[model samples]
Target: MDTPGPRRLAGRVWIVPGDPDPENIRGSVAVVADDSGSVVVDAGQSPAHAREIQSAIRAAGLPPARWLVYTHHHWDHVWGACAWPDVEIVGHVSGQEILRREAARPWSHRYLRDEVRANPRLGPSFRARALAMQGWDDFTILPPGRTFTDELTLPTGVRLRHVGGAHAPDSTVALVPDSKVALLGDCFYPPPAHLRAPDDGPDLAMVRDLLSDDYEWYVDSHGEPTTLEQARRLVST
Candidate 1:
């Protein structure tokens, strides 16, 4: 399938939809434009993908992305940080530890393949998907430069709250209060079976708590944008 461009969501917000292809799982990237500039959520899976998002953001006539925020430290959600050296990166404090650890690991194809072979249960799917993408020569992982604890409100009024769950202990939710849009990342999904993750699924209670807010739309990293009613139904199930 041809890669799609960023689609507008609410006032000053747009999403570069994710590709669910088994071999190349690209997570969605959200952009919130404010007077200062664009606040992007998730740098994407690769530098190439991040470049596409940057191009799309420019094409949409939104300001250049001044801030790149990570919902978690997962590779699919942040490996593209290398592409935005000029943008300030933001993430949960806990995610910094994970990214630091990831930075130490050798990301070469052979090393990754060997690691996957030796510890096949951990993240074979992630390895397979990453390997399928083009150019691993410059595939560098970077930790966030600026970290936050419970919550942070950007200068633009985009609020970020740490709402960790089963998917990731450092998972966060980005809320554009004025726009009534929330970017939920992959926090609502259960861990992949291959990882043998101990937790059953995301904290639905915390997720449900979000429904009490005034968000009109909820977007998961790999799914279509959903209305409040649709989001409620999803959380219930």
Candidate 2:
């Protein structure tokens, strides 16, 4: 049988793990379902795996994904988006531009040197992990069919709000008011290191503001479900 998938967060919200090895950088995709149908938050690495995500949704009693919201322009996030054909793809306006730029550049040298080469203090195995996480050579850029800045609420009642920037340029977080859950993309990771300087933004404060008392639970692109208290500690430290 296939490896057991990631666990569910709340009703209709499932967190699926992507290549979880050190190099691959623990990436997780979230799935949400409602009367309007199902929507996937950030597609994972492999197209085949993304189809599996669609399968998981169907098994969970939701329709095939009606929409895909890309958190940012990262290859791991958008690589599998094509698996959901005909859906209205959405992303930040700047994210679209980044995708275009990546597509135009040669694949072998996609990421900045600093990103690919980490400090040894991070670990002796850091280089291997960095290479594995930089799985962008085969990525194909798919421009978002719909792009927005500031904030946009979907007809399904889920709100897409730009949380300044954290993990990547033009990164945005998705908030589900009814579920009291927020898809934090890559903004906030759990303790030890609550916030890291984002590729584009300063720190995790933007993510913290979005998670302020309004949201009870948070689903990050990585790590387990988090809470407002955890986010608060993260921001404070």
Candidate 3:
């Protein structure tokens, strides 16, 4: 994969794109560096992907990540935390609730198997992911040891806010105030048809309000980073 450059703003920022799929499920991770140390947003697609992302961050001149944050509760976004056994994880309380619920119900590969059996079109991709998640039975749910309800200020000067977005209920976005860059995890992706019943998604009005933010660079999880104008346009899509 051609690694993207470390696009700098106020502080150093790097976007590590992961395994892209037509479904746009493979989420990317953001690595931010300030004077204090490094901060990684979201894990990657898997454990191995998480490790590779760490190497890429080092190559970009950032120090080891002092924090690992989750954008939401989706498996594709949070599964990589397995690689960072000791990093202090940070995220929204909603995510912890979802993980704990799922852990108690013990949601696992069987759900995907049933999904694939119901929709034959999903067989190949689901099988591939299952194989990639070979040790998923041993996959431990790593809830954020530190969680916030609305917003919190990090020691590194980065600010995190819980933004109930279109994609998931517990989405969080990080702002590097000095640089005017905002790392938006999977906070705004359009959900699949299956998840559109109650149509739980980012409130467009709220997104419009958030877009009015002074952030120049808006980074999304599944694709390339965009300008404030481009992100504002996406609020319509």
Candidate 4:
């Protein structure tokens, strides 16, 4: 399938939808741009994925990304950091340890294969899918250079808050108030298949709090854009 291009969500916000492919589980990449430049949320899964987003940015006439803000420290969300060497990287303070560990590890398919074999949390079938991916020949994982504890606002008007949830404790939600949109990057979802137990879901209070923002649309990293009312109903149930 030809990868889809970024789609405008609101005012100056656009989202490059995440691919649900098991072999390539990439999270959505969001761009919020103004005269200052663009702030990208989530670096994507690989160099190829980051390049795809960059291409979209150019085609849309948006300024080059000035900052790459992470929603969490998951590999699929932050591994493409190498692609934005010049862009400032920002993430939750808690992610520092995790990213440090990941950056120290070897990234070859062979190492990853062994990792999956020994790490049950990675899932039983992940080894096969990891090996099946295009190529691990060219990739790098860089830890965020800047970290925030609670909330942060970029000079360009993008706001980020660490809203830890069951999906991932470091998960964050990005708000583009001017655009009236919330980029809830996996923060409202249940734990991933490998980590999920029968009763797992996002923390109701945390998810509900996101609704308090004056956003007209909510964009979950793995799902379609939803209306505020629709998003409210989702967390309420």
Backbone clashes, each candidate: 0, 2, 4, 0
Whole-model lDDT, model 1: 0.83
lDDT of 2: 0.68
For residues 47-116, what per-residue lDDT tens digits would candidate 1 score against the true structure? Answer: 8788887888777788898899999988888878898857999999999999999988877667767777
lDDT of 3 by residue, 1-237 (tens): 434544454457767775566443566778777656688888875676677787777787787888888878777777778787557889899889887775565445897788778987666556655655656655666778899999988888789999876678888899887778888776665664455556565456765666746788888776777888887787788
TM-score of each: 0.92, 0.76, 0.82, 0.90
Taken over the whole model, the C-alpha lDDT of each candidate is 0.83, 0.68, 0.74, 0.80
- 155-232: candidate 4 lDDT, tens digit per residue: 998999998877778888889999999988888678777878988866667767778658899888777899988878
Worst 10 residues of 3 by lDDT: 1-10
Q: List the residue pairs that clash in candidate 2.
A: 23-129, 23-133
Q: After superposition, how far is residue 9 of candidate 2 from its true place, in Å?
A: 1.5
Whole-model lDDT, candidate 4? 0.80
Residue 164 error, candidate 1, Å: 0.8
